[model samples]
Target: MTRSAPQFLCDPVLETVQVEHGFGTRGAVAPGGTLRPNQVHGNAVARFEGGSGVDPLEADALLSRIPTQSVAVVTADCVPVLVASADGGCVAAVHAGWRGLACGVIPAAIAALSEWGFTDLRAAIGPHARACCYEVDTPVLEALEGPFGPALAEAVRPTRPGHAGLDLQRLALEALSRGGIRSDHRGSAAAMCTVCHPELFDSFRRQGDQAGRMIHWVRPIRDA
Candidate 1:
């Protein structure tokens, strides 16, 4: 069966940079077999050093200084984050689901980009399950609040009697802030909830295993 091209959401902040980056919706086609990791909902980050062929390793984030190599991550309801240095020397793609976010994937990606001499980093948080529909039980709440403390806890509001809605965007911003990315360096989040907009995106929570995956990608522009 022929797959349709993915609908993409472009970040205006990232658009100002000398790089190509965007978040894909269902059916998006990634050029050049973009490097995608087998996200395990942990904080493991990998650095790509310009290689040939696709190597889908097990990791949640990917960083690269190679201008020709594009890096991406697949997600349904998970947050897809794209990062690039202000100078466009390096770029990174991260898949941060609630588990990955709680464990520190954003910080890990930032640290990796920092090691690549990318100090002034800019990031974009793509669409996912927002607080309006992302209700979680006590353990998930504890897992998020335990590591992030009150600020994150404050964002979690009771959705019902026992479940609370967690704001993944706020949590991701907190992690980015801790990693030294200021609000000015950040792009306005797409903010569309994947679960709420089934026509535009795929949601794992809504569609289960049958949900189609979206690919978010970034690449530095090589000088001719």
Candidate 2:
């Protein structure tokens, strides 16, 4: 009941309140003029309130309170996070990779939404590179230590010499928890992993820079 298309996904948490959203698969295109950020893999957030100006699209997260105007983020191997208020009055689309996670992009997006006076939030984390195929070295683990701290080991698995497989979804969920989104409000992870299911997803690790991105989107809707 949570999918809008055969390839696109939705979450019951957001669907319960009827927030318009879709987690893209491989070939879907985002609508024209959809608000998105430049995605620096940092914690910057951009806000939209039905404005005509397009300033500050340089953020990694895009939040909106306006109905109909879509907000989106693109991803291949990175996490695409969609968040909305309980009443569907506002929504956010975040692009989170490990660097963005270490920088607190998820938490930053939630904080920005809370600052806008909508704290009762719900979120859905889309597919990304899972631990099965996503390996990392010492530098990657070291960078993650600051954000994940003692909980870091919970999402890592030793693979090779000075390297390990990393689960980005777990860390993303942790970031969501730290951002104040209740445990139940953060929906379950998508079953597909970008690397493992190449037929359904685009994997940056598998296909390198030539991989096509998926456009994950969320649109604000009026509360009933």
TM-score of decoy 2: 0.93
lDDT of 1 at 170: 88
Q: Show model 1 residue runs off by greater than 4 Å.
A: 1-5, 52-56
| lDDT (Cα, tens digit) per residue for candidate 2, span 1-224 | 69445467788888987888888888876667788888788889998887574348698999888887789999999988999998898999999999999888888888888899988889999888887889999999999998899889999999989999998888988988887888899985553688988878888999998899998888888653
Which candidate has the highest TM-score of all?
A: 2
lDDT for each residue of candidate 1 in 63-175, tens digit (9 for 90 to 100): 87888888999889888899999888788999998899889999988987877778898899998888777888888887887769988767788777778888888888888
In terms of lDDT, the best-performing candidate is 2
- How many residue pairs clash (N, CA or C atoms closer than 3 angstroms) in each of the candidate models, in the order given? 2, 0
Candidate 2 backbone collisions, by pair = none
Tell me the whole-model lDDT of each prediction, alpha carbons only: 0.84, 0.86
